[model samples]
Target: MSIPRDTRATVTEFLDRLAAGDPDRVAELFAEPVDWQLSWPDEGHPAIPWIRPRSTRAEVADHFRALAEHHVPERNATTVSAIVVEGGNAVLLGRIGQTARATGRSYTAMFALHLTVENGLITRYHIYEDSLSVAAALTAAPTG
Candidate 1:
């Protein structure tokens, strides 16, 4: 579906800020008391459990900051392949491939960001990705 011009612009600008690794800009895209939900398939269970919760901009910033400190890669390296907007919601498909600075381990994974915007600011964000791929990338091989 075609997105409204204003919504499209807002989504694009928000993504640009995130890809640029500008935390302040990212925060600006979000409304106060934003809701953030991140989910992945469970590693050791039959059920595909989903992790859902709400968070504020400051909380989201801390999460991103931790990732940045662990991964120390080029800020603009993330690639957004597509964006589909429906009503007040937009879904962004993207991926990041980089080597972690702390462990010098290479990692690549795909991601989907589901966002809800209101009044030109994001109110909700739901992120989905491959948990196993992320775990493999982040964890060091067992030293026996």
Candidate 2:
């Protein structure tokens, strides 16, 4: 007999698939009408054009594409400091490191991610990261 998976399991599975970086594969995980937002300061960096409020699964996928195009990520593994999940809600605490394409300067920042999974699709996603550090890295001179 096969049992249905819970929200937490569904989320983990979806994230695991996304880790492969197949945009088409990940897009299948979102509900048609999804609410997504990558929260940051009002003065958003144009250099990182992928960060924005989105209301559809396509936009969510576009956000991923944007990051892939704008940042040259280092080989270092992303560190997940913490993860909290309850029912359909989850919060991820992690840090990421990447080099901004425009400035070619390294940027590292901690982030808190909020995710909501229902049935088996992502319904809500709100991620918060340090925007000031990103902007500075994009604007400041490269370190010698």
Candidate 3:
């Protein structure tokens, strides 16, 4: 599929910011009021507190911060295997590995993220990931 240069650049920047693990920088690439969506159930909210809904850029930063607070920094990992961009929309296929600090349990999950970039800012952020594995890692007892 032919992808727009500008769209690809924006997506690249987003990925770069994410890889840097800087929430503020990541949030800066997003629009003021972003449409954030995640694949999480209502009952699982407490188990993974960072997996919450967000709209504003500040909230976006806060979301990352919350995730950082709950997960071990050294154990956090993200690998983007593929990215497809068309116009201002992009989809990222990747795997994420993280260890829950509270329970000392780890989980790895595949994730598909859809982002809509308009005027150089991401407006829509929707992510579908293996929530069950993440919840299990966060809430389950440590195996070791």
| Per-model RMSD to reference | 6.0, 3.2, 4.0
lDDT value, residue 127 of candidate 3: 94
The TM-score, computed over Cα atoms with residue i paired to residue i, of candidate 3 is 0.90
Candidate with maximal TM-score: 3
Instruction: Please give the range of 10 consecutive residues that has the lowest summed lDDT in model 3.
Output: 1-10
lDDT of 3 by residue, 1-144 (tens): 122247788899877777788998888888878998899864447877777778998999998888888889998777899999888899999999999998999889999999998888889999999988888888888667
lDDT measured at residue 6 in model 1 versus the true structure, 0 to 100: 63
TM-scores of all predicted structures: 0.77, 0.83, 0.90
List pairs with backbone clashes in candidate 3: none
Pairs in clash, predicted candidate 2: none
Residue-level lDDT tens digits of model 2 in 13-96: 666755676665666777778877777655556766776666776777787777766666554345678779898888989987
- TM-score for model 1? 0.77
Model 3: how far residue 25 lies from native, Å: 1.1
Candidate 1 lDDT score relative to the true structure: 0.68
Q: Comparing candidate 1 with candidate 2, which one achieves the higher TM-score?
A: 2
How do the residues 1-144 of candidate 1 rate in per-residue lDDT, one tens digit apiece?
222246678898877776777676577677778877776533332221123343677766665665666675663256789999898899999887765554566777788999888878888888877766655645665323
